[model samples]
Target: MSTYPHFGTDAIHAGQDPDQWSSKAVVPPIVMSATYKQRIPGQPDLYEYSRSDNPTRGVFERCIAALEGAKHGIAAGSGLGATTLLCQLLKSGDHVIAMDDCYGGTYRFFTAIMSKYGVEFDFIDLTDISLMEKTIKPNTKMIWAESLTNPTLKYTDIEAVVKLSKQNKDCIVVVDNTFMTPYFLRPLELGATIVYHSVTKYLNGHSDVVMGAICTNDDELGSKLKYFANACGIVPSPFDCFLANRGMKTLHVRMREHQKNATAVAQFLETSPFVEKVIYPGLPSHPQHELMKKQAKGFSGMVTFYIKGNLQKFFDAVKVFTLAESLGGFESLVEHPWSMTHASIPKEKREAIGVLDTLIRVSVGLEETEDLVADLEQALKASQ
Candidate 1:
């Protein structure tokens, strides 16, 4: 059997051995050189070029790989960079089935850029096993999904999707395990072909860095992904990797507090007369609450709801929470999906996916529970 330290120990110590550094530094030092000197003309050092690999980035990659319970981890320039690399695995005639209510950026990439290459995509609800069964074709090379979808917080049973993928052996299952994080859910453990993340979000736990990662146990797939990153020059800078490494060390602690604060906020919203509907996997009212409990450890800090009153007034009235774009930060954020995050999605499709104008997507931070509730309480009143 394989042996490894606990999650916290690995997060702090993986790929961080001081012996690897000439200076014997406790923390992994950033190697900013564009190219490493080689002993001979043809022979190269372990990391010949920064595009292929960097010291700091390696540390973060190893740390994330350990956390995700995977054999390989590849870091990219941004969340979309990781996504773009994954799509590179496809060809002109390949078909892909993706979650209908996925992030706006992901939807835009599939419909606009990937489709232009003659790769066909079908956006459908992955939660319904029969829908996935009916929509899947023999040419479907990839089944992309998110456990808790963006803006709406709908749940997809990732394991069930993986089971279905088994029927089509050539197809790969990719889960965007961003909202759940490794702390809450490791999709690879559930038999997913690959688990990916927009490292700018929960993996970093701070909004400072924009990076992306993909972890997999498949050796051949790992090699292909790494080649894509190097050939396309879609690698993250050493400094950004350094910042993300620092941010990730505190992930376990931050996630706990995030869950605490978010659970309280969701409960409050469910009781509010101003809120029309609340979507949080942790709550019993959520459609997939029991399944979520079966598939993962805990729900992180995301809550989505529909307002019964003035949306603009509520967004403007928030005192503690900031009106912002990105999530998984130390500070609370409230975003309107229809006008803000999901604006790139066509209006008709947005409506079809249940992303209404009154829908509110909040990234509940590690703020005190009472204070966050009080802020929302007033916002609801003003929205009326």
Candidate 2:
């Protein structure tokens, strides 16, 4: 139930309807005409090009498919072009499973570019539901899910992987909500069949747009995901869809100031001494913090940890964090996921999924929680 049932008025008036235009302008007019002016000359009406349609990318894909309650919304050109337009809904001998701490470019686009197009993937640990009931076979078809994973935030439960991929009623779960962002989860109201997004982190919370999106309620899989985003042109730039719809009109107050400066810098790095572990599902020393409060309504601003000092001396002593390698932005950024974003996963599959080497990953932004906990408490006392 979207199109404005709340989440800050569906992020400032879902699809900003200023009387549909002609300058009634309340804030939706970036329509950079890449082509659109046909009136019965071989019948073309509701838009006809700009890589297949654009009115400022249909008002940020109908305000991010009405902030994920969704009925359709598709944008791309990044977030691995919405995972290559959802791997064109798979086929070449299809089979997938994903989510072994996903997001290192979606595990190198499912093992190096969709395994050269014959599909086939596996990557386990989807909260180990008995190793996904011993890997559902018979041409699997898709499962993916990511929830709060990436750089070791680990969460995967998307309603128990949509109740075990409906025992393959032609399986399809696909959730990567891109670090919990329908402003804190809405994996298609928890039975997900589609809920992608990188939307350049935190729904464009200002890392200056990189875009990518998807959402669905399944009208023929939203008409084959808008015909694979206009047949793989990978749409997205109408000025980065008007700067990601003006950063989703302050996505619920920038996700409550990025979860209040990441729960005050992960409770000062779990009472530092240059901490050793502190994953953060809004902490209860998170071990799925009660299944992240029984399926998220909060806890984002990802906070991964493990650092008993010196990771390049806390990335050369942070001055209000920013060692960088992408993340939801307003500023604070940090990295070193076993040498930046799971260094193409092979150091024994990034330490068999924990991504060690002093793993850090922060992303928490919208700063000023005591200046990001006095710059991570003087960069963990200059990394001890």
Candidate 3:
């Protein structure tokens, strides 16, 4: 048995043991069989079917669970798939309260797909404790939120939200810890009922795998999610699972560098004349900087800022930072959220929540901070 005593140690050794393999390989081998052989009548091996269980997928799930300090973990085909499976916990007419500034994909899922099934959702600014308290209906079954909201980098008070959920015993406080990850923040330790992640981002760190995961200390809830994942056939492939597990081994190291680069980038952007506003939880200028300090161990590589000139010129001038949609990788990426990641959201509604056209979101990578800052400086000058 492997001991997960610390974050860095657990990230590498959890859910993995060299002695378990017949070949005695140092790393877990990818088990790609669709079905396992039965040893007796009506009895099969550890995994009866790939959809329900696979050795590679199990290792990945267990590793994530251990990292989050949870008893169970469920992996999905995509981040949105995990979100969709989570909605299975709700039935007809069940109410869900989510943050207004959540990821656009989540908003679309809640409003478009889930609403068609007779589920109700209310998008509220979770920062306002009183407003969140007033919005909870008698039928509310879930409180969905992101620890650090996408693009905007707004912080959610997990403790406060958990307290509110306690008022209604049945209400499950589900947190999308995609931005912070287990390296920086473990929502399960903060009293959240569930924590989910887009493994395509930080957990994978290479942007090669598009997967999602759910971790929870609640055994029953974990079982339900696992069942839904099997029933819905939304589970990730064995190969993806293997890749995610490998990626997690270096998560602790990558996160520290990401945080260091992001802090420097945020500071640089804050002083740039071409930059209008910089929003990073690590910076004192952020509205929830102190709140993040209390809730998380460290900030992530994501940084959002507004530019002074034409957005297109700035987007076109960047040489080092790729103009991309996704985040949390080894190479830096920048995107115009209004037209990229958040485009699914109606312009009026998106703007109302502060995702403006001039808002540029940066996913600071492992590059030297000086080079990144110089690239941004030259890009700004060229745009001008």
Summed backbone clashes in each candidate are: 0, 0, 0
Model 2's alpha-carbon lDDT is 0.84
Candidate 3 per-residue lDDT over residues 1-384, each given as its tens digit: 765388888888988988878898779999999988888967875779999999999999999999999999999999999998999999998999999999999999999899999999999999898999899988999999898998899899999999988888799999999999999999998999999999999999998999999999998998899999999999999999999999999999999999999999999989999988999999988889899888899999899998898877887888889998899999999998898889999999899999998899999999988999999998988777
Off by over 4 Å in 3: 1-4
Candidate 1, superposed: residue stretches over 4 Å from native: 1-4
lDDT of each: 0.92, 0.84, 0.93
Q: Could you say which candidate leads in lDDT?
A: 3
Cα-lDDT of candidate 3? 0.93
TM-score of each: 0.98, 0.36, 0.98
lDDT of model 3, residue 151: 80
What is the alpha-carbon lDDT for the whole of candidate 1?
A: 0.92
Ranking of candidates on lDDT, top first:
3, 1, 2
Range of the 10 consecutive residues with the lowest summed lDDT in candidate 3: 1-10
The pairs that clash in candidate 2 are none
